[model samples]
Target chain A: MVWNEKAECMSREEKEKLQIKLLKEAIEKAYNNVPFYKKRFDEAGVGPEDLQSLEDIEKFPFTTKADLRETYPFGMFAVPEDEIVEIHSTSGTTGKPTVSGYTKKDLDIWAEVTARAIDMAGGTKKDRIQNCYGYGLFTGGLGIHHGGYKLGATVIPISAGNTKRQIEIMKDFQSTILTCTPSYALYLAESIEKEGISIEELGLKSGIFGAEMWTEEMRDELENRLGITAVNIYGLTELMGPGVANECMVKKGLHIADDHFYPEIIDSKTKETLPEGEKGELVLTTLTREGMPVIRFRTKDITSLNYDKCDCGRTTVRMSRITGRTDDMLKVRGVIVFPSQIERAILKIEGLTPNYQIIVTRPEYLDEIEVQVEATPSLFSDEMKEMEAIERKIANKIHKEIGLRVNVSLVESESLPRSEGKAVRVIDKRNFD
Target chain B: MKIQQISVFIENKEGRLKKAIDVLSKAGINIRALSIADTSKFGILRLIVSDNKKAKEALESNKFVVKENDVLVVEIPDHPDGLNTILGYLDDDKINVEYIYAFVSNKTDEAIVVMKLENIEEGMKALKEHNAKILTLEDIKNL
Candidate 1:
């Protein structure tokens, strides 16, 4: 199932050599073409010539999301506007969306990397890919679409929503591969059941789900519900789309296409590179991007990198699944808690549905966290004392996980908002100002 | 005989009790006797209503967590030693009383005590052996 075995299974020495060469060229291109990189390089007093080896990238100034916002639309593009063949921008919910421009060559590299991702997920030319990542401005849809095409698979560009239609097409077309965000995939699975379609009737063999942070418990739920091998894909709109890295059939971790985009783990606070196997913010460098060659782009995603060769026979370094974003981590009552921790704790309890909402409110002078979880049919009881005990158990588990005693509220089933895309899990009502 | 008591979970907040009462009143459900067991976070408002089913439906429709359980309604003299005499009978039989709340009956010189016990049958047997007057659901409704 290894795609482009030569590229993926290259010897460590050979891959590092290629990475060093690409890194040098990308740095030179960024400094000479893009004014932003040139100014940054000048400020850091480190030029492209200083990058002698792959490790030398540490001297470069790290590019951040804020830096991308400052540039706005096309400040990061290294090539002329005429050569740019495609553009993708983030949702920009936080502020202005950071735009990523790609030349025709850049698009080809994107397709190649995504094709490798598809291959890693056990996809082949005969497989039908039902891509549900959303088309238009979002890179997820088109990214997987082009990658499926490159792999010579029959790509169904259904592009997100219309749950009934998605189920119908999936059954009729006998799609062998499914691609979308993990949350949306779960939602689609729920819809498929609601539509009275048996999971066995569908021809899905595997799925490539990513774009939002998810937990291992979520993976188990998706796999059990859909009867497919659920694998995690890692990518960002700021980098390339969904093709940056993907988990193979081995499913140990996502295998990064380090040949194209170099991966690094850095201490988010210190802005220093962390050694392999240490969890920190993931920073990426587009080693071969022609249109927008970025140097040391801080992704802000928290994860660790594993250089150990995967059992799938790929020598390319793999990254552990993202745990949380530094920006999204919540601080409650002076205790730092990630929404993923709450999710993990809730999922550990039997008979509770995965759907939940964490509300952090300042009632008076103290901060309180209230976790409203949906009560599944199995969890709901006729006895009030039994229900109260379940609530107390959930509170105790969450308290053990986050070191903060939170109020657990058992809400009606499906009462919480399900995401068509990313599930909004946390609502912080405390005004920091 | 066991009497039906409806317990509504009310959060410890302003006007929550009023809101629960409002729902019952709007539904034409009459409250017979009520007691609240509270903690710092929330309260369980235990009630003896004229119509258990109607009161439960009303509170539940308003999104309240309501539970129905059996409690023994025993008739005790309105004098100071009435409750102590009943407790002494139950204690001698080793029957545990989880909770007890009472209201004076206007029709007689006796007070009606609602007793939630660890074992309702055992507690009732002990009370009957001691010649205690246990009121049925019909008796509480008429009162």
Candidate 2:
């Protein structure tokens, strides 16, 4: 099922030799075309010739999401605007969205990597892919779309939402491969169940879920519910969308497409490279991207790399599931809690994409956390006994996640928003002023 | 016989009850009996209205978390011992009355009691043997 044996399964010695060559070419491309990278390279006292080995990547300045934003529209593109063929962007909830421009060559590379991902997920030409990721500007839909096209699989371009129709297409089209956010997959499963459609009624064999943090427990839930092998796909718009790394059938860890993008782990604060298996921020360099050659971009995602050979037979280094981001971790009553932990706790409860938001407020001398869970129509009850039991159940799950007692309130379902990458569900109302 | 009742969730805050009442009023749902079980955290407002479907649709359209459950509406004398008498029969049968709320009928001297019993089947048998007058949805609408 490996798409390209030479690239995916090459020997480590040969790989590193190839990496050194591609790294040098990418550095020279970035320095020559991008004034931002040139200034960064000059300020850091590092030049293209200095990148002699993979280890020399340490000398290069780390490009960040902030740095990418500073470049704005076309500042990061190594190719001229006429040559750039496509653009995909992050949701940019906090500030201006980071734009990723791709040349025809860059897109072909995206197709190959994603095709490798789909192949890794047990997809092939005979498979029909029901791509549920949004098709617009987000890389998710089009990424899977292009991969399916390259793999010669029939791609159903049904984008996100319209739950009823999603299930209808899932049944009528007899889709065998599914792709979307992990939360949305859960939501679709619950919706299908509500429609009284059995797993035997559909043809789903595997799924590619990503775009947010998810847990192994949630993975089990999705696999069991949809009766499909759920694989995790990892990428950001800063990188070339969702083909950077993906989990193979062995499900050990996500295999980073080592030949295309180089992966590194470093202390987020100190900027020092950590040894393999030591957890830190994930730093990536687009070694082969032509339109935009990112040099050591600090992704801010917390994970570790494993160079050990995978049972799936790909020599590419695999990274553990993203636990959290350094920038999004929250401190509640001095105890560090990631929104992913809360999401992990929330997933324990039934109904797709549990609608719960953590409300942090300091009423007295202490900070208190109250999680507001929406009482959806499927879970709501007319009796207080049943409704309160649901609340207490969510509260107990939250307590187990973070060893602290917090309030649980069942609010009207309308107040809570449906998260699809429904970013920022935590509300920090505590004021320091 | 059991009748359907609408239960609406109300947070412990000002003007929530008024908003819920306004929804039903604008829908022109004539409420037969109404009661509020209050806690410091929140309250549950239970009601027997002229139309259960209309009232629920109205409340839900206004963004209220409304639910429907079955409860018994019984007719008794408008005296203290009337409720005591009905309770003694259920107590003899060991059926627990989870909650009970009463409304005085304008058409008669009898008081209507809405009771939610944990052992509903047992409570129904006991009440029937004791000759308790259980109201139907139509009887509730008339009351």
Candidate 3:
């Protein structure tokens, strides 16, 4: 009942004054209670008194993923386990899973932020949302679920799988809005067509897709198929999951909730902060997080920032679509590639299954990549010559997409492994010891 | 009849294969039968062509790593004895057969045999004396 569009649209001065007050309180609480921050401040030769404004906030040391790893699970937690009502964690693909806890008040604030995200993407209480994000340790599902409830929408709480049943319920429940990763949305679209279901008649209106980067070309494709607007939502488990920012109707960069979470862009390698409009890594400091207050937490996502007011009413600073992660990018044959680029290229080619793998190996002392792509029955025939031609076409298109040539092998459709959770895009064999 | 066969060494890189194809495309050399023997390193590209001489010259003139090797193409009846008859000669001659693949036959009642041999001239002599139909480039191309 308390969607604050007016507060969201407030002038910069008004928001800054409020942000400063919240930031001060949050910093004070962290310095007093959190041992990690207490030691960091002691080593920096600074105290809570050094932070008069946001400028002095930089004197604080930056926290890296390694720091979270060092602490393991819940070592940085500001409150006891009993006071913490909820816990969320990273997927742990890279190493040990990093966990964060949230008190009841923390959950309330998180829900409010997510509600703001839903509202900006044009959701209403009358809408029925089919939430398709993965649940459990992964924060995407529960994070969006809490927000959808706070917004008073009829949330289906259908965590990510069973596409048949999901599509079935979309029609049965007349679900108006959908939330999931862009990869899964396209998967659902394929299912809808295969089952001879009418997506247009389902009364589905809009979608919010995140957890992975997608392209404008993919957006156009999904929009054409589903006849609905697909917006981008961005967040990470370390940063409190899928409501840190969202795209408004303007379809510009995602608007960050700067009042609650102050965002800064810094050079990933140098660790030096960059000015607005410059592309760099994102760093966030939670101004109002209760249980797990993070200060200058380095988020390796590579993107530019937009401070100019958007056509949409929100005055919060907007961040561009993440081009690539500093660590997620791969250097093959002197060419830098992000997995998202491959997804974009595959999506552009109609009748090509999105399930594919990038197998990187050092064969004969040179970096080589073979893209094992799956062929839809409609796009290929059993004839070896036909398969060869399709393979050539895919290789050529991929060359155009990433500016690097890749060996494309056409495998049987659905032969490539499908992920129940996040799809593995690249397998690097660089021999990292 | 003769069956044209051509072999080229391909570096294991992304666009190298495309460049090779582009070279063949520009030269008007139509590939009849092709296979790649890939290792962890570079691949050996083997092809049985409609015009072996033309493919060889086209590939060579373009500075492609090309070679002409005598790989025996022996005809066998489309029955079980087809393999035994060919292997009997090779086994007697003490010539090692590296690998073998059967080709679709253009002939009415026989299939074509392609084999890599350690001693090419010795194997050819044995096949000829054994009344084996030694397939020429054109013979394999037509079949």
Q: Give interface RMSD, per candidate.
A: 5.2, 2.0, 14.4
Best by DockQ: 2
- Tens-place lDDT digits, model 1, residues A28-102: 999999999999999989998898988899999999889999999999999889999999999998898999999
lDDT of 2 by residue, A126-154 (tens): 99999989988999999989989999999
Residue pairs clashing in model 3 are B2-B136, B2-B137, B2-B138, B2-B139, B3-B136, B3-B137, B3-B138, B4-B137, B106-B143
Window of ten residues with lowest summed lDDT in model 2 chain A: A415-424
- Per-residue lDDT, model 2, residue A281, is 96
Native-vs-model 1 lDDT? 0.88
Q: Return the lDDT, model 1, position A101.
A: 93
Q: Best candidate, TM-score-wise?
A: 2
Q: Rank the candidates by TM-score, best first.
A: 2, 1, 3
Off by over 4 Å in 3: A381-389, B1-143
Instruction: Please give, as one word, the docking class of candidate 2.
Output: acceptable
Model 1 misplaced regions, further than 4 Å: B1-143
Cand. 2 TM to true fold: 0.86
TM-score per prediction, in order, is 0.80, 0.86, 0.74
lDDT by residue for model 3 (B1-88), tens: 3233566655566776777778787878676556777644345577776666777667655545565656777778677787987899
Weakest 10 consecutive residues, lDDT, candidate 3 chain A? A377-386
TM-score of chain B of 3: 0.78
Tens-place lDDT digits, model 3, residues A94-141:
898898889999898889888888888789898898899987889889
